[model samples]
Target: FNFLGYNVNVNSLLANPYCKYTECCNDDWIKFRRNRLMRNLTNHVYGQPLLQHAVDALTSHFNPNFQNHKALVLSFHGMTGTGKNYVSNFIADSLYINGVKSKYVHHFIGRLHFPDESKIPQYKEYLYNNLKAAIKDCPRQLFIFDEVDKTPPEVLNSIKPMVDYRDDVDGVNYSEAVFIFLSNIGADVIREHFHDLYFEKGRQREDLQMIDFEFLIQKGAFNEKGGLFHGDIIANSLIDHYIPFLPLQEEHVKKCILNEFQIRNVNLPKPEHVEHVLKFVEWGPDESLLFAKTGCKRLSSKVALLVDKYYRHESRIHNEL
Candidate 1:
């Protein structure tokens, strides 16, 4: 079946979705495994200290009873490749057995799904029906909206019925669902805030709290002509947490390169090899903390170049023998 640009399979997931709504079967799909998600997020996601708050929010929302009054709405604000999507995937992996690919998980990119701003009316109706249907079919649903900044403001109101403070919209409770909105709206604000905390204020970035940033990103999002701009999504206070994702600095970039090496199953890169990847990365904001311009966006390609060169050199030495 086709639902919101994704193909849905009505196999075990649909026919027997009993495990999703309860703890009886002990199955993994949409089961809130707090410790597993926490461990993975702690280990895999790099340079995102704010994620600590996210962890707190998630754990609290998904208590033992797993009773949420409304959909757990997390609005992620950051630049591209700053672990926004990565963290979202980790969340999916933690909650669902099949992760992002699970029929329960519905990821929509604004640019791809609702590209034409003029068609906001049509997009709104289409999204409204899909979301309502998905929630009814499987309450343990995860809806990730990527590139949210590109989606029309009117189109987002389609989400109001699901995220609002209501027990049920015609008997379907949205409390068991999740809605993640990812954007690059307030990345610079976060970067500047971090710089002040680290340098002028001489405070540790680690010491910063959600209170310091939660509002800044929200304000930026409201002011910016993007996802949350003039939308009831913010005015009505539908978003639970305005999680700010900071831009990656040099140290984090180095870590990303090393992490990328491990991901590719390549040899542990030597110091020089790591430096080579660093050299290709552009860093600035000039006179500031010098965070990566693209925040590890093109890192995979750069790491690939190093890996290919290493293999080629190894082959030459083997042939020499």
Candidate 2:
């Protein structure tokens, strides 16, 4: 067989299974080497404590010396555009050499994949089969469930067995696999708690610790109306960590806008141009303390439009000159 201009023996390659797939692994490694997951994550606007905890968890999971390792189950709860999904993608990119595109990474969107509540049983079975197959193929598989708050309890519970620490399941070991759940189930509580601490209590955002917010978020998620309602996963302590994403303040949104400008290589005419661009974004319902309802989700397009307008005006001025 000729592959990439190299003449190879098909029979010999088949005889040596490891050699047959060496190219694939090497390619993945090359991709991984180019990714700066930790650096990129640190550059994000997440709190210092959250970033530290996440880094610790990921490092421990990647450490070969770590013993009695179960699958790292992380449940990210917070508001939309608060970086839950972004962080999940970062973890996926960090773990496998190919990042989110790696065969070992599996993403499931709750609303898109399991919308019908009546067919939860079917969804559960599908989730189980796909997860098992993925883990069977690669023990280090990463499973990300986005919008978990929208997923039915029954469907979410299907992976409890796999999330558990086990030597093997039906002769396949998945102890090294990772499960990440992204949700907005406890966003309001988290935001309110921070508001009280920052405003009423006169505490700095950094002073507001995880211990102060984790309990409230967890309680909200387990309530009847919450996503994990009546599920044994939380009660039985199946999840290892419940990371809360803080609501983005106006400053954070501005930073996000600047990041977008950098990504698109667009320069603003002035520093205040960021604020001007922000006017296009709708704020939260509260008229007093303004915050971006959708965080930086729509900031990119807004920035792009503003930059285009600036360039068009400049072009017209140059033509007149």
Candidate 3:
């Protein structure tokens, strides 16, 4: 059965560790897991074979011992619009497909908070409540925390329990969960710091001065490889700055790539699809309708209602015709 774009092998992928989540049972979980894993592959850096190997390894490992590890923490750092969120979700989804439950995929980001100790308890309480809810559903799950570095130390500390010990709730140790932290910090900082090397190493042959991510980083901006910085320097800074976490090295990125290509089994859609959808959203039926929708004379909500009326009128006319 084809579930979530993955070829399902119910007897194989989900032979062990029965999934407790109802939505993720039999072949459905495997399908979801494959999709998630495939998405992470797109962020794979070039020349990093280990990254691909790692993804493959995970795919291979899931079938036999799917429920063994609590969580697979994937901590990656890069620039904005570099597919950080996408990759993290991809990993989460892939794991879901391999009999991993949807409850396991927890996508978290930092929320703005005032620097006040009084608010800490309230904040922590809220977090604890949510964590309790998540654990109750699926004890063994994966949590994907996006924008990890951008989060404050307090917030980071709050999550450390889950990532390190596999449980977030106080006095409870849930070792069946996995944590994956994705960030656009370390690699981004490195690229900005050592951008000169990309220019000096005969990398950008073009005359364009303001280097965007594409030119500097050959394999797109998000991957640790070809972003407006030297690879070696980025590697070194990653080693120094992120001592224990390991700032998603080239090999790690390779795993992301392999996961992307293998799991999806479908090439990434062309830019035209995105452009078409955006244009469709922007386009209006008539000139007056366009201006009305653009909020020239009313609030956006009012304009949306007007657009809906116009569309209804148009539909009536078409039906009559």
What's the candidate order when arranged by decreasing lDDT? Answer: 1, 2, 3
- What ranking of all candidate models by TM-score puts the best one first? 1, 2, 3
lDDT of 3 by residue, 151-205 (tens): 4445444544454423344655555555555554455343442333343554431
* Candidate 1 displacement at residue 248 in angstroms: 1.2
lDDT of 2 at 265: 56
What is the Cα-based lDDT of residue 42 in candidate 3? 41
Looking at candidate 2, the ten consecutive residues that score lowest on lDDT are 25-34
TM-score comparison, 1 vs 2, better candidate: 1
Name the TM-score of candidate 2. 0.84
Compare the candidates by lDDT and give the number of the best one. 1
Q: Please count the clashing residue pairs in each candidate, in the order shown.
A: 0, 0, 30
lDDT of each: 0.83, 0.74, 0.42
lDDT of 1 by residue, 49-154 (tens): 7887777887888786666788889999987778889999999888877777778889899899999978888999899889989888878788999988888888
Error of 1 at 205 (Å): 1.8
Q: Whole-model lDDT for model 2 versus the true structure?
A: 0.74
Answer with 1 or 2, whichever has the higher lDDT: 1
